[model samples]
Target: MSELTCFKAYDIRGKLGTELDTSIAYRIGCAYAQVINPTKVVVGEDVRATSNEIKNAFAQGLMDMGVDVLDIGLCGTEEIYFATKFLGISGGAMITASHNPIDYNGLKLVREDSKPVSNDTGLLDIKLSAEKNDFTFADVKGTMSVVDTTKEYIEHLIGYVAIDTLKPMRIVVNGGNGAAAPTLDRLEVAFKQKNIPIEFIKMNHEPDSTFPNGIPNPLLHEQQAVTGDQVKAHKADLGIAWDGDFDRCFLWDSDGRFIEGYYIVGLLAEAFLLKNPGASIIHDPRLLWNTIDIVEQNGGKAIQSQTGHAYIKEIMRKEDAVYGGEMSAHHYFKDFAYCDSGMIPWLLVVDLLSRRSTDLQTLVSKRMTAYPSPGEINRKVADADVAIVAVRAKFEADSIAIDTTDGVSLSFEQWRFNLRKSNTEPVVRLNLETRGDAVLMQAKTDEILAILDAHA
Candidate 1:
């Protein structure tokens, strides 16, 4: 009866046993196949027990619609993007929950060149078609075949970063027990064969669906400790970790300090601008001060985009942007078909350091101090609207410009803050930054917290 059960603001995510059974997945695939009318579709899955089954069911649906399926079994989300472009497929889908718990699963759909499919695009139509239960199977059913896209993917990734040029550096990598190990293993061997003096301190490299070491989400403080400790203990050049599906990645400096994604955006922007001057860079509106300053200073254009992969990719496509990054650890590249890659950022940074005579901390230290931000703070309240209104109203009376494009962003001469309500959760996310002043940023952050408390 409920036709709007599968669609979400960004992707198709639902519980496993109840809303997201194999039948629903297959029907959704059939609907997608009919809508897109693509000849070839690339499919990939994460490290979950149900992932393969769901993927196969969806493949069946596609095949029923006379669409050939190119199944890249057990690969990361980025690999799906690579396969789509490398094989010139019509589109691709990745069955992954990302950082979600094992009980949940979802599908991230994309068009050719890995164009994201959101509600504004064709996701809503696909959902409606699936719910109607009137799929028109093709007279000639499509066929399916599996292919390993990792070799070409790794080769292309290596081209992005010169592993052979890497210096004798000790690095720490925590796979978090997800899908990162395979790629890392191949990369490690490549680095070794090239005699790029480097050492790998691997933790939780084994992929286990049960997540014995815990769910492979590096965003949580609990999971970040293992990589941070390894960085400190080994005095490694840096630490890298990935989420459940290895789509988004997190990093730590040599000193066991977790570098926020905001600074990394600046770092990568700076690095990319060095080679491609006068290029355009895309960034989410959540954190703008640092990215804007860095991009502009490096002779690159900084474009603000709405949150989510779909919006970012769409904007990048139109603008032909060279790079786009989000503070949430999503990095998109032009060569990668405007798709986010969890493997590219660290490699770029590492290559930059290897070619130069500087350490990771030294490279980012000045920028970190110049534009310090109160790393995204989340507060759970009963009503996110009430909290956002209270915060916005309190700040708007001070002769500041306010915009609600995606959220309430108040800009003052000295400082600015954005308070947005999360669509995926019942919470208000706040990010504030000052003009080279940590004390002022902290003061504004505390003031907003007081308003939140009073309203709560």
Candidate 2:
């Protein structure tokens, strides 16, 4: 048995040909089937060049294990989640690296009802089983079928907003040459069918596995300028972009100013809370004041969970939270089987914009002013834990409140910051926010960086 290093905390991802290949994917499928023993499993693939081959191999392995396969070809990760719950399948897997470099490919798995299969849940065992390369074949192989889930998924997304209530608006949508293009096409047709007036200025709207523009990661500052520039060039009311698998969405205002994901969480929370007052909202601990403020002000309960989709979804299910959002732009909803969707967040925001009769900038500018955050900053360090501990020791004395819910979050009277190590990389992430004071935020950010730099 060969070693397998592709499995990670939340999903399986690795460089193609080296750490992951068709054979490895097949082994993973077999291991998943044997471990979970699902009767039927749904499979989907992104627009990556190797995705089809990998998907087919994985399905073959599942079928050999006597597990029926439902292949929903050329879709996003959220679509697989939607199909898994909507079709009542036992399990599902999405073949995607999700904004990783073109040389990479991977899988995101889920159990019944779109419940995530993270390391803590069952991914580690599956990894070990695959490494063992031990499989007992069943006498009868299960059947395979193809199903197109686009229409139903689009309809489900449209339900989040009222078509008639949306005012005529021009928007720029940069699909980043990933899985979002096809879905955007379906959305256009749906809008036309409902007679909703929306002009979509498409940029990088085609799915090209080569990624001519770059990987579709909007979190990178370099990848964001294109969307912002397109929004300005088209004079669109707002700009929206998605990562490779379209599970996360980023936004830019009318003036081509990129809005941080932290603020979007607050905006979306306010939107959901208005619809379902007193509902619970789950938020990540990295950046809290803004989300807590918005949720509480809107008569909603704000619950803090660790920073990850699995954690947020579990907390959402436990609390029956109406919505859960991470500052990284992943938004989960109760109606979507407690899964995250890239399409729904923008639609809800558009509805809010139309109802308010204001541009995206106007809607979020005051909130940004009230709670200024420098966004999340990452530093590559030799030892992330050492750096985190040093920063904690430096700030522990002055902090009015300290919480280790996810990492080291220390709160002061006028400002606060969270310093935590990355789950998948050798880096420390720092997030700072202050009370309506950009200067203070900057100063505190610099102070924290100096501490980090000294240790680095």
Candidate 3:
């Protein structure tokens, strides 16, 4: 048995064969069974090549511990959450590297009610158990059964938004050859049955583990271009794309420009507030001015949170927030067990556009101009902590205020910047936004980059 090194701060992930394999995955399954100790555990995998092997090994390990396994085959990360909650099963694990490279595979585990399990959560217990490699087998092992959640997931998603009186709209979907194609294709079928006014244009809808086009991460400019071109080519109202497991999604305007996730946070906050007025909403601290402005101006309470899914979800459940959003394209809902979904946000966005006779550009265009943000930029460095400390020291001389909810976030009257260490890699991620001043945003970005570069 090899020592485990892929147990990350957030989830278990590593390069295939070297850092992870069927054997290690099997041990993790057993460890999960031990930690969660649920009577039944729901399992799911993405469209990756090694997902099956890992899923099978995990299932075997679960059953060996006499824990019943309900396998929902070939679904996105949120689908597993739905299965676990919809079926009242124990915790579940989704086999995906989530926007990681094709050569990598990992797991996202959650407790019952779709609560995330991070390193500080039950993952530590799982790590210890996997290292020990001791799983006591019962006299009779639990059985494994396959369940299809496609239809149920679709119904649940559509139920969140109005589909009956949806207006006629042309929508372009670019799955980026990840898991979103199958779900979107099925959703298209459902939209057709409802007589909803929607024109569907699907591109790169096939699920290819190799990701021949590129990694499905919409954060990259090149990746966004492919989907943007489709939106312009089809002359569609909006375009949407998903990451590898389809957990978090990205959007493009009718004019083929990538809508920053910060504005989408405001858009969805406004959407939910219309229904449940005065409901609390959680906003990540990284990008906050516009989200706070829109949420408060619209009679919704905005609660600032740290930068990760674990922190966001925990805050949501505690505050009973109606909605939560991260500028990284993660949207969490109170209805969906306070878990993040790449699927629900688009559905709600579609509903918003349909209900109001407005195109995607019109809905978010004003916010973009009002809060022009320098999109997130990352810099590789030998010691990310050193770079962060150096940046903080420079800013401390005349800094207005500083907060380290997730990383180092400095706030000033005109501009603000969040310089944080990446949880998964040896790089520091930077996000800077100004109150409608594009020039100031660029200047702050350049200053931060210089600091990071000097440290590098």
Which candidate leads in lDDT? 2
- Give the least accurate 10-residue stretch of model 2, judged by summed lDDT: 447-456
Residue 350, candidate 3: Cα error in Å is 1.3
Sorted by TM-score (best first), the order is 2, 1, 3
lDDT string, candidate 2, 1-456, tens digits: 667999998999999999999999999989999998999999999999999999999888899899999999999999999999999989999999998889999999999999999988999999999999899878999899999888899999999887778999999998999999999999999899999898899999999989999999998888788789888888899999999999999999989999999999999999998899899999999998999998989999999999999999999999999999999999999999999999999999999998888888987999999999999998888889999998988889998999999889999999999999887888899999999999999998998898888777
RMSD of each: 1.3, 0.9, 1.4
Candidate 1 TM-score versus the reference:
0.97
- Ten contiguous residues with the weakest lDDT in model 1: 1-10
Q: Could you arrange the candidates by lDDT from highest to lowest?
A: 2, 3, 1
Q: How many residue pairs clash in model 3?
A: 0
Off by over 4 Å in 3: none
Candidate 1 stretches with Cα past 4 Å from truth are none
Best by TM-score: 2
For model 1, residues 288-310, the per-residue Cα lDDT tens digits are 98899999999999998988888
lDDT of 2: 0.93
lDDT of 3 by residue, 68-116 (tens): 9989888899999888888887888899998888899999998888888
lDDT of prediction 3:
0.88
Report every candidate's CA lDDT. Answer: 0.87, 0.93, 0.88
